[model samples]
Target: MSDGIDDAKRALRAELRERRQLLSDQARTTAEEGVHRQLDALLARTDVRSISCFLSTPTEPGTRSFVNAAIERGIRVLLPVTRIDGLLDWTVATPDGDVTDGLFGLPEPVGELLGPIAVNDVDLLVIPAAAVDHRGMRLGWGRGYFDKTLGSMERCPPVYAVIYDSELIDEVPRDVHDQPVSGVVTPTQTIVLSPQRH
Candidate 1:
């Protein structure tokens, strides 16, 4: 069963990755703007004071604007620093801050490492995903970094996955360790799953 799930996930990831790569530059920009708008509205509606979010890579739905805007609003932002042991460390993100090369070509903050459990301090958590299902299951990049982090948390805040609208599906293949998120933030809407079935 695990093998079947893994194969299915790989197939879905390839399909989504291809679709993302094929997006036209103008379309990608428009989609990114929509994402920013939705997230901005989310900020307005909630009293969340702190969040842990990812610094998006080029092919992913852009989070740079959202991260910057969050910082501008005086919201504390924590970015992940991938470690050698398949766990992640946390670091504060600043608008003018630069990132250093880290694992998997991720650009990590060049500040103090707040250890692995720093995520417990956030009011909310934002994560990156290749695809998400309607049930709020997120398909990550097969590294399991976020999965490990999510699984270890004793009491977690609302966790959201950032993805393009089309990436949300009816279902995604699941492994035993797969963690479901509380909500999803797409370019067009923010869907919070009720009766979260994690």
Candidate 2:
């Protein structure tokens, strides 16, 4: 059973990667606007005081607009930094700041390392994913970064995945170590999963 699940996951990931690569510049721009609108609505609905998100890379969904909006609202924003042990460390983000290259070429906050905060302290976690399902299962980039980080937390915050609307599907293959998400924000909609499962 586990082997079958693993194979399905691998196949789905490959498909998602191919689809992501096919996105044209015009499509990407349109998708970005849609994502921004959905995210703004989600933010308005919640009373969250602080958020932890990532710095975007070219291949990843860009987060500049979301980060800027959070900063403008005076919401404390945190970005993930990779630890030497292949884990993630959270630090607050600064306006127009520089970041050093971290694991998998992801950027990390460079100035004044704020150490790390307990995961429970974060009100919302904006997670990146290759794809996510309506049931809250997320398929990551296969590095196990967020999985390990989420597993290590004693008390977890609400995890919200950001993806293109087309990437949201009926289901995703899961593993024992996989952590379910609380919600997902796509270009078209904000999907809130049932709280009982997570």
Candidate 3:
């Protein structure tokens, strides 16, 4: 990554973090509800039997309701379990299961890991992103966890980034290793991005 692009990304991440933190309680609830409705409708049309998803933190676009609903529909939902080496392990999450505290303030699953390559078992992947551009470029939290995971997959599924509507912009600063997603899901809509080659 060039120093200029790296600097811009740092600034953008900070700005987005502040925006999330400033959301009011009422606004947050409304957004979560909206996301739930949109996501539920999106899932109804897909034949995905298994999914790889992250357990959202408070400020992120909500996924808890979707996860529970998927499980209820007999879909297998795998949640990421962060490892000491910065790679993520997969674990099956049940609606009633407990989420214990994990690294970087993340809530993690309670079972033995299915290992990093376990992600390949999923039919679809819904990942976290600070911002995703119209060109499908995803700007993640500085750590290269998701990028590395996506890069290592031998036969990757369609990966979608979950973000607020406003976070889907014209462009975001990118590094050589930055991974692009196939689509983006916001509170109001699911956008299918055109394919981009590295």
Among all candidates shown, the one with the greatest lDDT: 3
Q: How close is each model in CA RMSD to the real structure?
A: 1.4, 2.0, 1.1
Q: List model 3 lDDT by residue over 1-198, tens digit each.
A: 899999999999999999999988887787778777776776776788898888889999888888888899998999999888989999998886788998877778788789999999898899999999999999998988999999889999989899998999889998888888999999888999984858
**Please, what is the whole-model Cα lDDT of each candidate in the order they appear?**
0.87, 0.79, 0.88
Question: Residue by residue across 1-198, what tens digits does model 1's lDDT show?
Answer: 378898999999999999999998887787778888877887787788998988877788888888999999999999999999999999999996788789877767888899999999998898999988878788998999998999899998888888998988989889888888988889889999742445
Clashing pairs in 2: none
- Stretches of model 1 off by over 4 angstroms after superposition: 195-198
What lDDT is obtained when candidate 2 is compared to the true structure? 0.79
Stretches of model 2 off by over 4 angstroms after superposition: 195-198
**Model 3 — which ten-residue stretch has the worst lDDT?**
36-45
TM-score of each candidate structure, all chains considered together: 0.95, 0.90, 0.96
Deviation from native of the Cα of residue 42 in model 3, angstroms: 2.3
Model 3's C-alpha root-mean-square deviation from the true structure amounts to 1.1
